[model samples]
Target: MSVTKGLVKVIKLEELKPQIGKEVQVLDQTIAIFRLTNDEVRAVSNRCPHKNGPLAEGIVSGEFVFCPLHDWKISLTTGEVQKPDNGCITTYETAVIDGYVYIGEPIQHEKHDPSR
Candidate 1:
């Protein structure tokens, strides 16, 4: 069992098979889960980082998800920008128990680099 802030319970785990995807809504945010060839499940904010486009409806490939809005490639694992103007997407810790996928609450990352 895991505990996190905001009580963001585990939603799902690596269920989306390669070449397929799934969407899960948590609170006011929707998350898109993609299963890569390496059998890794990556979840990202369902909304596009650019125009708030629904990323859950986007096409996912490999370690990247192509935004349906402007075709922005967002990385799943590192939450880094795979393309220009594309930025990090919020990710929640995922775990699997008895073949059930659980999306843990968002990890409260401490504020760093105060020099903004």
Candidate 2:
């Protein structure tokens, strides 16, 4: 439960398989970590904003994940739900250090504006 610069240790690099989601608890917040096929790591809220679906159990496609409950496409980078959907999920910062993964505080994204 060590936190360095607001980042807490989560999991090992090797333990997270490519194109697979790994669920981890950091600061009592459940997050889903994904290792892309290109070796990039991303962290997002484990539960989807829609239907409270388990995002970790969803399918990964590119930088988006389809909610297992209703296929709501969510962006791992921006935490925004795709078009036709109206919602947002929390995104977290992730870092890999010495083969271990660390997670930072939830990223504060800009609120959606309907005036657009």
Candidate 3:
């Protein structure tokens, strides 16, 4: 992995398959990186809000991931847990630089949706 001043290279862009999640370590956090069918790369906390499920092992559908533990559908983009279940996870900023996947800090937003 390559390291820049503010970005941490976690994996290669080619190493991430579309619609699949890859587990990676950045600093002290476990992150789940996904390449969407549209080739959008997203990074989020690897644990599901509902039961602390390992999201990296979850299934990816569109922009959402179905938590492997209890089938909680979460939005990889906004980190919003879809309805029927309500919660949110930490979403990190990601970039593809020089064919490498780099992750930045957590997105500046409220992680938990109490209104849900």
Candidate 4:
């Protein structure tokens, strides 16, 4: 599927397990989708800047995820480095319509979780 310039077709909302983390592939990019809370859903690039860690397999703690490859913590909401000085990966804008997720080509903030 051709990626919409400003949009990314990452995955279906049904493919995600609530309160669980899932990785969706978009071309060469891998996106990590997580249910942060009962009312929150977050998506971010799965690559950890500190060491190119696989973040999708990491553990979720509140608003952050601990990198499983190296134990680095990254915020799922802002895609910011929670406790390190390294840079952050590209985040995508996300939205849901009728249960399917539309990922923005760039990081876009979400005010509510559509999973509920």
Best by lDDT: 3
Regions of model 4 farther than 4 Å from truth: 1-5, 108-116
Clashing pairs for model 4 are 91-107, 92-106, 93-104, 93-106
Candidate 3 lDDT over 1-116, as tens digits, reads 66787899888899999988999999999999999988889999999989999998899999999999999999998899998888889999998888998999999775554657
Q: Which candidate has the highest TM-score of all?
A: 2
Q: What does candidate 1's lDDT look like per residue over 1-116, in tens digits?
A: 23444334444444466756678776666777666787666667777778877777777777777788898887666555563464667876665555555565564444333347
Query: Of the candidates numbered 2 and 3, which has the greater TM-score value?
Result: 2
- Please list the residue runs of candidate 1 whose C-alpha ends up more than 4 Å from where it truly belongs after superposition: 1-15, 107-116
User: What are the lDDT figures for the candidates, one per model?
Assistant: 0.65, 0.89, 0.91, 0.73
- The all-Cα superposition gives candidate 2 an RMSD in Å to the true structure of 1.3
Q: What is the lDDT of residue 93 in candidate 2?
A: 84
* Residue pairs with backbone overlap in model 1: 10-103, 11-103, 13-101
Query: Order of candidates by TM-score, top first?
Result: 2, 3, 4, 1
- The stretch of ten residues in a row with the least summed lDDT in candidate 2 is 106-115
Estimate, for each residue in 13-85, the C-alpha lDDT of model 4 and write its tens digit. Answer: 7777766788888767788888666645678898888888888888888888888888887777777775435
Model 4 TM-score, all chains together: 0.75
1-116, model 2: which lDDT tens digit per residue?
Answer: 67888899878899998878988888778899999988889999899887899898889999999999999999999999998987888999889888888999889988878669
Ranking by lDDT: 3, 2, 4, 1
